[model samples]
Target chain A: MTTMRTETSTGAEEVRPKSALEPLISAENVSYHASGRQILQDISLTVARGETVTVVGPNGAGKTTLLRVLLGLISPTSGRVTSKPHLRIGYLPQKIHIDPVLPLSVNRIMTLTGSFTQEQIQAALEETGVSHLNGQSVFNLSGGEFQRMMLARALLRNPELLVLDEPVQGVDYLGEAELYELIANIRKKYSCSVLMISHDLHVVMSSTDRVICIDQHVCCQGKPQYVCNHTEFQRLFGRQFSESLSVYSHDHDHRHDISGNIQEKNQ
Target chain B: MTLLDDFLWRAIFAGLGIAIVAGPLGCFVVWRRMAYLGDTMSHSSLLGIAMGFLLQINLILAVFVVAALVAILLFLLQRQKQLAADAILGTLAHASLALGVLAISLMTWIRVDLMSFLFGDILSVEISDLYLIYGSGLIVLLVMLKIWKPLLAITANEELARAEGIPSVPLQLIFMLLIALIIALAMKIVGVLLVTALLIIPATAARRFSKTPEQMAVIAVLIGVASVFIGLFTSLEFDTPSGPSIVISIVLFFFLSFILPAPKTYVLR
Candidate 1:
């Protein structure tokens, strides 16, 4: 039942001085119980106006439940969640199964939740590099293409907060890094706050402002480098895993082209 | 004047009204895979009829009340997670149906035609029944149109829709109520046993021609209307049962759909 604050450490704050602002969403001492099992216990976290916070945890760690709570889809068993008034959020679920009986096209999915102009739809699809898939049936999308289509669909709202669960579940290794880079670009372009759940511990996005590791509770919370070096992270995912995380962080000099070929960083 | 006075014309008009509404509503039932839920609600309508006869109230109103209650009970029962969903539906469907039969048997004073109630007597529809069909049908269609986008969003991905601030629970309840209304209205045309078939068959037949959900719905309505027309005329010509004939016509259309080439835009995965 430990409560952890997501206050940015001083050194990390020095790197991105303007990252902190009024919190867009915050949860206090939130705990959720289902079927007599405690799924989440005494969890506390906050996402500021322009910060990207990634929650990394093992399977069955209640990460998705926590996201659902923050999104106001479900109320917590104890404690409360507060958010800014009229906060607009774009969400990409882990997976969306469009039944074969449903005849939904990718173009139609863009307008499923809200009205968007044709130009807006085109822009959102082009931003995610899936404009070619506009008229295609959602049921026929490839894994990577489907993820991109969902990302585009989420962006049509021009949300102030982006909540992505997994985001790259069915994508290949090469596409995973590209998708993360795309997310980083989207965050920069829109300057929207991002709250995401990542299962990729070895390649935790270097652009992440903070990383919170949890297994039914917050194990550690701080900058990605700080959490990667902490004993709690090492204990949860072995020391070997932590070392690989650091290695991945240092070798982030290259970027991938759309064709999956690595290009040297010009930035 | 002759057309308005004839029973055959009245039956055709009543069937058309039900078919038009059933087209769009049935698409949701098929998409959500709630054909069994429709079956359960329609089955409970027989209980509504038995109670109506006992209390001397309007049978349609009684049926709507009972079906709506069954819908709410099913919703609550599903949240419990103890019994499997299909098992609960099965228990409720048959239990209410058998109870309705027993109740009707106990009322030996009233002359109830169990055959017509089970398999429908569409040819004997009165003008008052036509008024009920169109009145409630229009309301259901209007309400469905109002919630069309949000309902489709929820059907595609409920978590995403809820996260994006569509009230999924209330919308689902409203959808269940709409189904109950449709079942209550449809009971007179197709009876308790075949109402779900009227809902599910036309929607399935329309799938081969549609590129979008709205297209599917529109095509389903056309298919349903065509089935009713053909089935009625076939029954008139051969002296067969009208409701079963309609169901058979739709089943034939479903099979006929297989002969057409697949829709050019969709690639089945």
Candidate 2:
């Protein structure tokens, strides 16, 4: 099994360039409640520009709720969220059930936000690798094709923040890896910050800059490798994934190839 | 031979006006699966009629007010979380129907034709009724046109719509009010019992034949207008009930839709 090796730690007291350090969105102790039951506790997070953050948690872990709150779909019960003004957000839901009665083509769905020139629409679809499906009915597209089409739609607005909620819900394992690679490429090309919720922690960690482990609260957060070694995360997900777990400790935790081994350095 | 002088001509014009508005509105009803919501508003028109008599006000206006109030009530009740939406609609529909009947029964001074209100008296449509139908129906259509894009977005996926900055709450309230207005305008033509039949059947038939929301809405209007003409002519020849005759024609069209091949190319606009 491939393992994520920790490399750099950004949170450490070290000199960092000011222009590259500002966060695109920051939540200061946000909490959400529905009726009397608490759905989200005092949680905080920050996403910087041109970085990819993956939220990992069990079912009903308030991941979706956090995304909705960040998107301003629902108000937090208390605390505050500060975002860069005029933040253009591109959101892709887990799965959109477009009514077959509506007769929506893939190209037509792009026009839902407003009018877009044909060339611009073509460019976005091309970027997402679904250029040929521009005229096809959205209902007729396969699961992978649909996700790409949705990504195409989200890319049309030239969003600064791209938010995806469970992008690989029904995708096959191979397709899931390819889609994450595609997303990473999109982030690099657009220089946009990405916030995504995913259950496939194993594959996504390679592309992710930061991983937040949450269950009704922000249980642990840091670089992907650091969060993977968190006690709370192990307690929550360790039962089903005992063998494949790879623990790597480093001074400055950052990106690393999964195939790299940590045992040689320790020896 | 003058259009205003003949009651049959007046009935035809009134039914046509209702169809123009009801068809597009009904497409939304079918798309959102709110046929029962439409039914609830239509059924409550009876209580509106009873209120009209008690207040000595215009019947259509009273019906409009009552249906609008019921729409608001449904909105409020929906927030309670105590009862499911279908249950609330069912309870409201039956309760209002019973109360209207009771109110009519208690008032001995007014000689109300209960069957006409229930089944509608298309033959009895006055020239004044035609004015109300066209004027109000025009407003409903215009409002629908203005809100078409956002309403379609909401119907397609409400969470996505909200995330995209559409004001879903106001749009929903406006949609409910539009349904209420259509019910009030259509009550005299199709009656309280079959108003939803008028909205639903034509829209459903059009769905099988249309390639776009706009196409479906336009075709729904065509189907609705055709049903009205067919039902009216059939009533004149067969002497059957006019409202039920229109509903039967629409039902026939809906069934005929199955035989026609579904449209292949979905036009974007």
Q: Note the Cα lDDT for every prediction shown.
A: 0.86, 0.84
Cα lDDT tens digits, model 2, B62-124, are 999999999999998997886899999999999999999999999999999998888888767
Candidate 1 per-residue lDDT, tens place, B24-129, comes to 9999999999999999999998899999999998787788899999999999999897799999999999999999999999999999998888877876588777
Give lDDT tens digits, candidate 1, residues A41-160.
Answer: 999998999999999987898999999888877778887787866778899887777798998888998998889988899899999999998878888888999999988988888888
DockQ of 1: 0.65
> How much lDDT does candidate 1 score?
0.86
TM-score of each: 0.91, 0.91
In candidate 2, list every pair of residues with a backbone clash. Answer: A7-A252, A8-A252, A8-A253, A8-A254, A9-A252, A9-A253
* Candidate 1: residue B51 lDDT (0-100): 93
lDDT of 2 by residue, A16-109 (tens): 5635455778777889899888999998999888888999898998999999888877778886777766677889987788878776778878
